[model samples]
Target: MVETTRRYVLAKRPEGKPDRDTFELEETGVSDPRHGEVLVRTLYLSVDPYMRGRMRDRESYAEPWDVGDPMQGGVVGEVVESEHERWSEGDRVVGNLYWSEYAVVDGDDLSRVDARAENVTLSSYLGVLGMPGRTAYFGTLEVAEPDPGETVVVSGAAGAVGSTVGQIAKLAGARVVGFAGSDEKVEFLEDDLGFDAGINYKTTDDYRAALDDAAPDGVDAYFDNVGGPITDAVFTRLNVDARVAICGQIALYNEEGVPTGPRKLPQLIATRAKVEGLLVRDFSPRFREATEQLHEWVANGDVEYRESVVEGFENAPDAFLGLFEGENIGKQVVKVAEPSE
Candidate 1:
């Protein structure tokens, strides 16, 4: 086993957007397990949009990060040493493991990965069976409330949450229209995932026209992941008493200046639409319920998912920055260390 542990620290808070310079890699001594804690070797680390907000000093749903501290996110790791009653060496667990090669976390903070799926990797607990998937399952079903035969429009439709939202919407008997950045992703939605329609937002200059063609009957529910001009366009086409679930705003994440687009506050009144922002962590109690359903769906072959993994702990910062470039098709994960299993 490696003696020295590698980690990524927040070098400086970004004035606007985060870049490679924002993170600094450092090596430190491997920590020993304290009483009631376990030492873990990280396998997979999640890179999510919510982490972007945590990086900022501003107030948000989660707390801000201190400069020079290692960044934090969900991770899957194997136990190397344990002083806790609930865990032992060789047990696999998932928890808030900071960007590091090894971690020492409280036994209560980690959960054992009990169920095994044939052909499915353990890192999936950080994606599909994890927070992002739960966000899609609950955020769309409970918040968006798409009824049968209704038309649902989703943005960031090829990402982990968006893709799961679209597929779940389809199974619930809704016509799904998705927006993706690449034709390959658009095709994946339409052909592979069985979406009713898909638009390559990058190729199309007019979002309104593309949505008009995809959802001719009007959008009954909009699951927004990437908010911007496209969200403005989506709001205009909402049917009477439509529902809008605001998941995330990836487009505005790296903004250094003012934002431009027709404000949709007036449209909410015009269409009698209810727009609500959703945070996955808020529904943590129902995570097991959502993941069970999603896992069953996956086992029964009712739903499918994809992952874009960047190899190595050192490359996490670049993989995180790549989210803005539309470099990932589904879940973007960073493989920090190999699985011992």
Candidate 2:
């Protein structure tokens, strides 16, 4: 059995965008699981934009990571040793585990993954069938609630959550428009994901004009993942009684100070738009329901997903930093190790 583990720790709080120096890799002795716990060997780790919030000294939906402490996020792993009856050796599971190669976690904190399930990969548990998927399902369907024939625009449309939101809106019989960072992402949204229109925000000189040209009927629902000038443009085109789901604000996640942008409340008031922030954890009680539906959608070809996987555990920090750079078309994950099966 492996006796040592390598983990990434928060070295310092990032002022604006986090760099490689923000994380420090440390090697430590692996400990055996005590009663009601299991030793997990990480197979894959998720790198999300939300983790940036944790890098700050302030509090948010996720607790701030203290400097010198191990950074944590969703991890899919195999149970190498178990002191809990519910878990056995070689069992595949997923949980909010540390960035280490191995971790001693309580059985209750982990959810068993059925590796035998058809078409399901271990990495999918950290992405499409996991938190990002759940966030898209609830945020679009529950928060945005786009009615049939309505025009729904999604910011960050090539991303994990944003892509899912656009597809869900399309499934609900609404016209879906998307704004992505690159031309290739715009193509993916339009050609592969069945979005009605896709705009390359990187290429567009006028966001409002591009949006107006695509969504002539106006945006009845907006699923915002990146909040910045693009979002400001979206606010201008909102139709009456529009619904906006504020799922993420990736655009401002790295700013050293609060960025001042165009005031949008006046537009919201004029349009009577309702904007509500979303956190997937709030829908935890219905996770199974969402997961089952998402699984079905993926299985039946009703939904599609992509993954940008970094090859090694050592590259986890790089994969995370890539989020702000829009390097991934969908979910960004680090392949730590293969399952022991």
Candidate 3:
């Protein structure tokens, strides 16, 4: 029988930026599954930038977590006990299980995951096969539709969504330019990830000049993950009829207060560029179709993925903090609790 459980609780809401002190470790007894629920033992907990928005008490696409509550995020788990007919014991699933040893979830929230599907690991379904993957897929194809031989610029080029977006753009015959935080990340994209060009944003003092040197014809599509000045730079380089798919604004997440804006409204109007924010959840209706296509590409070796796994349940908080520092190479995950042998 399951006994005690440990969870990382939101100890204190961050005034400006979050630190280790924001989370507190707490233990409780494992909860029983009710009639339409199942008990899942957490395996891999996903750490993403979107969680930063949830930390704020402000309203957005999702609800904010109350102070002193368990911090929630995407998780892949194994069903240990089940009172639901849809999920039997030993079935693996992915859902919003939070930062806990175990969670009793309603059957509706959990989706069955096959570890060996198309030779893809279960952890991948939480990444390239899941939300981040979908964000790259639909956001690029639907939001930022590019013609063959056009130029595509992607910010946060080494992260999960950015990396995938670059590859997808390349597959569609676009010349891809990537903007990343480090020389190492730039090298990874250019040499390893097959990007046509990569600019180290941190080292480069003038981003607009860098873009000018890299893409002389200007950018046709911009897959933006880090907003702010990088996006501002892209705006000045947009080709006629260019599209900017806004995915995330991670650049401003750490700031305590909103900074004064030197508004880019004039640039937007001058370029006549279409800028649309994309949420992967909005494309959930076509998720299965996209997953199937992605799976085929992966199996044929046309698509690739990378992961940074942190071992142990207790290390979840640190794994999360690593995102802000760019400590992770790709998608970051915490191996919270292992599967039953």
Cα lDDT tens digits for candidate 2, 1-341: 76999999999999888999999999999888899999999999998998999988888989999999899999999999999999999999999999999999999999977644555678888887999999999999999998899999999999999999999999999999999999899999999999999999988999999988999999999999999999999999999999999999999998888789988899988899999999889999999999999888887778888899999999999999999999999899999998774
Model 1 TM-score, 2 decimals:
0.97
User: By TM-score, highest first, what's the ranking?
Assistant: 2, 1, 3
What is the lDDT, from 0 to 100, of the residue 227 in candidate 2?
95
Ranked by TM-score, the better of candidates 1 and 2 is: 2
Winning model by lDDT: 2
Once fitted onto the true fold, the runs of candidate 1 whose alpha carbons sit more than 4 angstroms away are: 1-3
Q: Write the per-residue lDDT of candidate 3 for residues 95-134, one digit (tens) a residue.
A: 8776898888898899988767555887887788788888
Which pairs clash in the backbone of model 1?
Answer: none
Flag regions of model 3 displaced more than 4 Å: 117-119
Q: lDDT per model, in order?
A: 0.89, 0.92, 0.86
Better of 1 and 3 by lDDT: 1
The TM-scores, one per candidate, come to 0.97, 0.98, 0.96
RMSD of 3: 1.4
Give stretches of model 2 more than 4 Å off. Answer: 115-118
